[model samples]
Target: MSVQPDLFDRSLFRIRRHRALKAAKPGADFLLRAVAVDLEERLLLINRTFGTAVDLGGHTGLVTQAIVNAGKAGRVLRADLQVADPNLPLPDLVCDDALLPLGDQSVDLIVSALTLQFVNDLPGTLIQIRRALAPDGFFLATLPGAGTLTELRDSLTRAELEIRGGAAARVLPFADTRDLGSLLQRAGFALPVTDLDTITVRYDTMFALLNDLRAMGATSILKDRSRTPISRRVLFRAAELYAENHSDPDGRIRATFALVTLSGWAPHESQQKPLRPGSAKASLAEALGAKEQKL
Candidate 1:
């Protein structure tokens, strides 16, 4: 199937707006900094063969700087859909889609943090990353996994259905671990691995969480829906439902963020390959029949 390039462009705009508004919020920045630190630690384990590194969806060059600080200054590149801040010290900052910017086998490492969930063609993007990497290159990414924001989503759904007779907009599209691993493999990355980490954040009220999402530029992007402003009645009702069901005994509402980290390597000819169909000595059905007869 063909990929939609426009969706990525739109997502970039949303992300840009989100970062701009929430730039001063220390809590969100703290979470992202932790992730960036973890990514740097993982990069250190790689053999130094990867002289050149490219960061996909590198919004503010945090991860890119991490790579540079690891002693790869001249070879690090940061790519994003929007024009990156020119002042952020980086070797290269290109305004382009992750799916089709870098050259074939030109980069040794491609890292994306909390960026893949908004991408509609994740497998296609992975394929592009694979193509951009030299043999033995690595692709590392972090995305929101399923179960993120369950409390907010469920409360919104229940309240919207009760008040407006329909569902509200979905906040995000997160992938499961199995599907993520398969996608990496299908994209020609070898030794695919995925692991999940759950983070639960407490908010004094549901409205506080909602405002944080807005400041973070996490509004729904459903184009077909009406752009009319949400009514105060609906908002209050939603908050009530959220507090009743999503709040803890201490009165703080909880929001869950499930981070799924993925890693894969570019394939090499030296790797083992499965035997071709009809090349095996015996079929599974034949082996089963023989075993039954012996029994």
Candidate 2:
């Protein structure tokens, strides 16, 4: 099979994150914390405790701490690209998401927070994650989905087109729910599921939103992006377009974040499976007390 071209610059992604640490604001991790809360709630619903858990791409250990705080896992370890801050909690294993160092069936759980979208080979990474899980082990992750940052993408493309008569990909692509669920199944997970939650964050201006994106280490790092720097004229025009098009009644502009959550389990004989075709436990019409209509 042909290989897909690398879309993201992983090195640049790491560098941007390290730079964000130096100038990290108090609320720079707002998105991470939001995902963490939802993840924690999901964990609470699962009854059993994990013997060991690895928090993949868990920068600063916020999700790691959340996993611990949820009282779900007996022991938790963290992995990331680098240690951006000495004062903050560092990763237990510093490595790429696509190349996990853990052995086969070594971990009872793996949780990734807002990281997979940057990976160049997401399907391969999912397969690696599946291999890392113990039999019946759980895998949970949260990342920005296809609809995240619609306003910024629209504004930037329109502004660049209007100013320079052309546009480049200023936004990174994100996976949709259906594709991710299929990936999990392809990775050999027993019961793969994907869902999303959308939230809008309002900002006073586009510049402020851009600043926040930088602080969050979420700026575009597409490898094929144009080398020419964005001119101030184009930048200002983009901001104006953002304001004019996406602003709320109170004057603040809206930025949408669609957080997709993925969950699955390693295959095991004990797990539930779909029945064979034409082997029904009961007739659907009979269950509803209605006669079946022949096709």
Best candidate per TM-score, number? 2
In order, candidate lDDTs are 0.74, 0.90
Clashing pairs in 1: none
* Model 2: residues with Cα > 4 Å off, grouped in runs: 288-295
Q: Locate the minimum summed-lDDT window of 10 residues in model 2.
A: 81-90
TM-score of 1: 0.82
Q: Encode model 1's per-residue lDDT on 1-295: one tens digit a residue.
A: 9745544346555565546543645454555676788888877776554778877766667888788776643587777545554345443655545446678998888888876776657778888889988897888888789998988888877887898898756566578988999999899898888998888889998888877776555656554444677777877887898889988999898999888899998998875678787898876768677543433
Question: Can you write out model 2's per-residue Cα lDDT over 232-254, one digit (the tens) per residue?
Answer: 99999999999999998999999
How does residue 102 of candidate 2 score in lDDT?
A: 88
Clashing residue pairs in candidate 2 (N, C-alpha, C atoms within 3 angstroms): none
How many clashes (backbone N, Cα, C below 3 Å) per candidate? Answer: 0, 0
